[model samples]
Target: MNLNLYIMLKSSTIALLILLSGLFISCKQSKGLTVSNMKKHHIESNIKGLGDDTILVYYVPLSKMGEDYEPIQDTIFSKNDRFAYDTPSNEPILLYLFSKKGEFTRKSGHPYRPDEKHIVALVKPTDQLNITGELKQYYLDYQVQGSAFNEQYTQVRKNYIEATSEAVSIELKLDALMAINGDTTEINDLFQKRNAVNSAGRNAHLEYIKNNPDKDLAAYYLTRQPWEIFGKYYNELSLNVRNGIFKNALESKIIKYKKYTQVQEAELKIKEGESAPDFELRSLSGNFSLNAVKTKYIVLDFWGSWCPPCTKGFPKMKAYYSKYKESIEFIGIDCNETEEKWRKAVLNYDLPWPQVINKLDIDDDVSVKYGIKAYPTKFIIDKDKKILAKFIGKDDSFYQKLDELMATK
Candidate 1:
């Protein structure tokens, strides 16, 4: 019941690979991909032991992905261990699967981690992905038949799953040992061996991509690699592969890493204590301009709904806004997400402050202008747009500073 939260930007090699296998397939929305115009694809599964269960389906509109993203959700029910569904896709798109309200048992008292409770597919037009396996083996071991990408992903995932199997077994044993007050001396040695085994598996997956630069699987793996590795092979990819369905996703990752041929193009540099750089976003009222906002004091909250810490501070932030609404102006600059997600978060949080989205595609994105690297980054500016102070996280320090500054007000 205590499901681990899905991490959007974890840096683990296998985690990145899973994210790529399921979420990194993307395209540009401006290219005009509509449901009516798209081709439908088939997906069916027959896994033993999964009776009368539902597989939760999720996919990000490949066209409109951002650093902070959410997958659109749908579900398919399986009765008697079989199910099928159809989805529209003009090009390759990632689909993720999991059983709702289910945690497949492992050994003794530990269950398989929720993070590992997943099956992924690279769905394409006219494609039929058939998943067949024993549910107890976990989804990664599922036999996904239909495409070369599936073949490649399954092969690499085997190594990861094997390592995780051992890791999970060790974890359960460690828990049992700790519960009975058993000797924990061997536990350190076991952890060291676990790390060694996992490291070997991670290296194996990394090498698979490194050797197969021309494969589409390589594109996904390369996204997680550093520039030296990513840059070297990204160019080595075939022309079709380079400009394939993952073009936007790869390009977005490039921009995030701030490397490759886009260095000078992404050149927007500024620091605190300097005059805050001006930016603009269209609001329901009209264009909201940073320079045009006339206020004695402004609280610029740069955040995203996907970020737990960012959303966690909403109640306190709302309370502060209520107290200071008469004199201080508060602005919410939603970063690294689709506009739909931004709007949903606005309503969900009932953020009482004026909200606008940051232009992630543009060079002068507010996050870049102010050099913000963390979520819930705060900047307080005076009426003249002079940077008064800055805070990197959600803490009482920002409120403390605000109280100190507003003591006279």
Candidate 2:
């Protein structure tokens, strides 16, 4: 019998998720089950129905979860989703039920009360589930196909292991080339597929070689791609980037692939030693500029309201601002988030700094001037407009750096 490739692929992904979840949960246990025992303990019984797309799997929960477990049905349980009761309470096993909605519609008898421990699931014999044997054959066929495809994928990636090793080499070569020549423009052009024509051209060259590697035409066409032109194709391109060496060559052709992205507009460009760029920025409070706070050291914080880390970092920033308001200032440039979310996070986090919005992206000329790339990039500027330090992420070193900068000259 035959089955849809999409369903087969989706089931395969679910299986992989289950394996990963099991591994993650098991890591916390001191006496984890052996791999052979794990396979034996896990029961997976497949049932195919009149609706050929859905597969009904009946199995007891893992070693940690008991059979009397009541799975969370509304918020947690879905037919196709995995669930684990035997594992840690925090780590629920995946219980994938084949359903059209891809979600379980059943509500828990308890209704939002997550503390309940015991529940029961009904799994009848394959001949008793009211499904024909023909449909079951499709399930069997799909399982075989799925397994074969997975094995092939694993082998293909393994075959390209040496080629993948070339990625680091490409990075090193690019670094050397950049060191020798101040201009990165030519190298940048190969990676940038800003236009549709360029994108289509790049993909076509990659696909042709990938599907037809034996032909001289494919080789010639692949050599014409950008990565090949730079003589770094073998070492630079990723497997997902396509066509092995040829794809790597094309990838190297794309421009600014490794360039830093600006997360906000209205960002200042002045370097640590250079005079800070002058700007008039507007906020709900009113327009303000750096000149107004010339005597105070300032921290330029770039973030988005939607960013969770950005939200978490705000309280620490608030504490620092509260401690140094008399001698230091904070100018926040909110980027790539909605006005509502931004305002909400500010109010929620109780941010004390002078906040402003930059509608333009961080990569714009204004952001480029400051060399801003990632979110929550904090820069400490002295009263004389010299950059003292740059901090990324919430780490012990970041706090230490901040304290050292704030300690005084």
Candidate 3:
């Protein structure tokens, strides 16, 4: 049902918030429900003037692996103007609701319709939640009651939606302006307004956290806040609250936060002009080491086959590699990809330079050593193994820097 387009229009705000929240939650395999561990919850949904529509319940795990993994889903048919379902979990989990038949096109008659058929809310064990809304309004006009956490979540989410609406509007206007080569003055004003709105959202989030320190909703919100703010207030929660079922996810976040801190500290020591960290990883041909490469300069490209931006940027990188093959080496460090997809991407892109796979996991030892944060992160190193520059994503400036370095020799 064109889920991509559906999500783009309907869930842009939620997606943006999730992106800004950074990586904190990790989903773990659920333990099989047993008498000792089972906690069941009930959800009764009433959609006015609906008949014979299929309702879907999806359980989304809050783990790193679960982020890309398919959610556990169940289906129920609406009858007598209401639909109900039961969820069993060992702890609190996130759930998403969708109507199989609801789809609405935008006012502009965009070919793809937004999946206005759905809403998401938090649920805990033993909670009985009631949801009431019209099929037409869906998420925007829905009302949820009976679960305190869900109620608080709705409140916090409203503030976030309001705070980001102006920024999102400005961004859309900027996109239209750029499409038509509109006035630079208008573009700059939009940019300023966007940043101001984002700053206001962050401030509002911080205030919400301070006022609701003991609530699980606060812990959930904490996971989405920036690391700097998270570090400031994470320790303030009491032990009992921290150890609660809903808040247990924060434990893993704490561990990752510590690792992120260590990586940041390590990056300071290996900044530009410092010697690059040496590591050995297996390539398709043989074992390759950073110190053994025979070149005056090296470009370490950390990426994954699944990342669209990584693949999109490859043509430019390939062009650069062809131009600099004699004097510079380009090494593609494929991270968080299956072996088959990795090989396919290398062949698909016709990457001529040396390539290697992280082969272990997303956050491998080599990536940690270099403080790699995002995909398609490139580090340019000189003959002495000193880092010349580090850049993320593809741009003319990246090529310009490489050209300047190449011109030196």
Q: How would you encode candidate 3's per-residue C-alpha lDDT over 47-95 as one tens digit per residue?
A: 7766666555566555421133445656666775567666766555677
The per-model lDDT (C-alpha) reads 0.67, 0.42, 0.65
User: What pairs collide in candidate 1?
Assistant: 27-62, 27-63
Most TM-score-accurate candidate: 3
Task: Give candidate 1's error at residue 265 in angstroms.
Answer: 12
Stretches > 4 Å off in candidate 2: 1-272, 361-366
Deviation (Å) of 389 in candidate 3: 3.0
lDDT of 1 at 195: 73
Candidate 1 lDDT, 77-188, residue by residue in tens: 7777766767665755677776543453433543344344577788876787778766654334576889999877877876577556566556556666656756767776
lDDT of 2 by residue, 240-309 (tens): 4344323332343332222222212323444456666555566648877767777888878777764556
Ranking by TM-score: 3, 1, 2
- Looking at model 3, report the run of 10 residues with the lowest lDDT sum: 1-10
Per-residue error for 167 in candidate 1, Å, reads: 6.5
Q: Spell out the clash pairs found in candidate 3.
A: 26-62, 26-63, 26-64, 27-62, 27-63
**What is the Cα-based lDDT of residue 41 in candidate 3?**
34
Instruction: State every prediction's TM-score relative to the real structure.
Output: 0.64, 0.41, 0.72
